[model samples]
Target chain A: MSTKTTRTQDILDRTPSSIALYRLLVPFVIVGLWELLSRWIGPRVLPGPVHTFSALYEGIQSGWVIPNTNVTMQAVVISFLIATVIGGVTGLILGFNKPAYDIVEPFFLSFYSVPKITMYPIFLFIFGVGLNTKVGFATFSSFFPMLIITMGAVRSIDDVYINVGKSLQVSRYQMFRHIVLPYILVQLVVALRLTFNSAFLAVILVELFAARSGLGLVLQHAMGTFNSEEILIVVTVLAVIAFVINIIFYGAQQLLEERWNMTSDEQMGI
Target chain B: MSLTGLSSLPYSKQIRLGRATLLVAILATLELVGRAEWFDQLTYVPLSTMVETAYGLLVSGELTDDIITTIGLVFVSFVSATLVALVIGWFLWRHDKVKQVLDPYLIVLYAMPIFVFYPMFIIVFGLNVFPIVLIAFAMSVTIIIISTANGLAKVPDVLIDVGRSMGLSRREQFRHVIFPAAVPYIFTGLKLGFVYAFIGVIASEFILSNSGLGYQISWYYQQFQTADMYAVLLIVITLAVVVNLGLIRIEDRLHRRT
Candidate 1:
């Protein structure tokens, strides 16, 4: 669940254990360079880590951080949930019917590849309010990735299981429960990781564009005042939040995979 | 589509027809809704009107500079990011210890909100094209690096051995064996890199820049030219879909090769 291990486990774990020392040391090196750079650029424009952290602490103590962060988090969470449910169900249903999947697959791919930024304005007109646009953009952005991943996973369920279920004349519910659901259950968490990341970033993006109150507003205020330390503080806070969310989902994915005795490699027919 | 739908056509043609029909259905509904005055004149824009607005802008040569700027930035950012990523990727591939140290950081970098530094970029580089390019490059480069490293790593051991057995030098082995073997993976990276770079450039323009395709769209919306906004939005959407479909075509070709 640590940041280091949140990447594909095999790739992250393949390095020699001794390399772990470098992993631990790299952050220090980056911080050192950052400090020097900040000094060169002038601390007012680019604050050092020490100053950033101190400002973060002060910002927290001043109590503005909580309300703003709360607003962003609420929007992100709601959008994430909405996207997951609708996208997952749609993916599952379409994924099961090959004909439907083939027709829709191109649509999904187009949606996934098209940057939602271009579509944001249209939504802005349709929704008309900043908050509606924010949540709508986040949800809309997250939906395709969730659907695509879920659909792909569903489509990859081994034919053997379905064949056996067919032979046994299992009910659709039973077949889904004993076969299709099991495979996707593990992948669902993995898909959620992507969806959550997308949702969080999308929310932040809209907040940056037009939000009454959010961490992005905090960031905008800092930029307005040329408060470099506060900008760093908010950036750091966001990074930590994103990092922690990734780790949590990753841990859940690992746990689910172990319980299912199925890694993505197996699901992928690799 | 079901067998009942477009059953007379070949399968691929049937799919195309089905998609066309679906698209027409959706667009027709929108056109009807727009004509019905459903969302007030200020909000909804019909499809035909959007096309007319786009034609008007094109004929008048309006948005020409903005279109050029957006396209130029996308091209520059993608190419630069690709070049930088390939070099870094090679360095990482050759240096196991360095790769180990950078792997997690790479993931973090790819996922982190690079826009957090957008404020600094603007202040440091000023409100020029440089900041936008830098942000787009940052947005795209990490995925390319990771993909390049992955490709190089996946180069089959047998291929390398074959190169060595043929008395090829280390450099020759990389050039002939590793690079060719890694083309598919690298191409995959480039594809994703381009997508990210395009998005990053447009998104940055939308958020800050005073001029560009993204800016024009937002400007139209803000000025209450809802039809003009949709028209420009139509342009952006069409560009996106065309480029994406083109990439997917090439990607499919690459996959077929591999």
Candidate 2:
């Protein structure tokens, strides 16, 4: 078995470079396909990748992209932070309190599916413009998943460790720091990837509905003017930004798992 | 420990009662606030009033049209997305090199705010149900594809070996062994897919649409008919919660089975 494993590892080690080549080639192939399809589909409706990239370049050079992206990202980040902190605490409480978890979890699960965008008007009325509404809306969008996972993380911690800590007369703080924190932190990172997506989606959505400024507004204008290239540019930039954030969160989760010596929630089937 | 003997009830019964009581308390608080007019009429409509308005709307067949239209759009897009995604995902699982190449793109699509392209969809497909369907499809298909692909990847090699030793064909192997094993994961994807689809479609309507439940709510809001809007939202939310609960139940059942 060891000999077979070593042989397989050797084969795996040799293949990554080739896989990297394919990964790099993917965007080029996609761009090429887009360009070809544009010719047949008509440039007005579906501009080539070259044109879209140039427009994106112009937007960046002229200062439209940066400020808009800043405004949108500010809302997303602020909401995400608020959701994470509050949701984590709430989830910990719920996890340790079974009656509360049982009662609240169903509502959380049900609310997860509701198109929260429908309630934007209520936020608009309550906050009356500025940052709070977007942040609140985004927090609402992202909070449930974080809370759910955190609760599960707390619940899933092995009883053996807790019992050992108690038997050792470890202080509550020490018990948390030594056992609960590491396990929960890893799971928190995993949940953040999801919550981040939700937060960003909510922020952009509100911007789309009615915003004084943001990338969503830019996309809306492009739509209003029927400028396909501009629309594609904003979308591509947004996708790239989201992808970067997602990759960062994923990397962070992996680092935490390795460095903290934590078991990932998935391996426990939670 | 209770003098009234209340604590003698089963633990499960206590939980159910607690859940029901909590739910009622929340609704009752909202109802009380609405009646006392402590909150602005613009923000809080009495739950009773909202229900009454909804009944009137249904009697006039106004809400029925919008509900049917929105649900129809969701069903159509969700079904197409599921079929196409399953095909593409199954093909990718069969082709390792292609899956490797496409994996990052799928991740990006899944993470990105696909709803931002709702306008582009509208432009391409025209301002109609087509755009709505396409937006929902775009929102859902990537996650399904990714989940389906991951599920197939996790199908135990031992199961395949069992099927092979039985002289099962490739199709039979997939049908009897691989598909069943991967079902729980696929259900997870489907639950999220349905969620994204519902969000995408309704949100698209909220942004721009002439017909649908979302349109009705937005229209009322725009017209300053806050009570009417609240009523419609109440109906939509109830429908959403009930349907999603059903999906969650099914998902739990599947998880247990697997």
Tens-digit lDDT string for candidate 2 (B80-102)? 99999899889988887777656
| lDDT of candidate 1 over A1-270, digit per residue (tens) | 122243345343654666767777877898899899989998877888888888788888999777788999999999999999998999898888876788778777765656686677667777765777788899999998789888988888888989999999999999988888887787777688778888988887787776788988877776677776777887888888987787566557656655555555221111
Per-residue lDDT of model 1, residues B148-215, tens digit only: 88688878788888999999999898888999888887887887788888888888888778888888
Candidate 2 per-residue C-alpha lDDT over A5-67 given as tens digits, one digit per residue, 9 for 90 to 100: 322332345435666578788878978998998898888998888898988899899998999
Top model by lDDT, which number? 2
- Checking candidate 1 for backbone clashes, the offending pairs are none
Where does model 1 sit among the CAPRI classes?
acceptable
Candidate 2 regions exceeding 4 Å error are A1-15, A256-270, B1-6
TM-score of each: 0.92, 0.92
What are the candidates' individual DockQ scores? 0.46, 0.55
Clashing pairs in 2: none
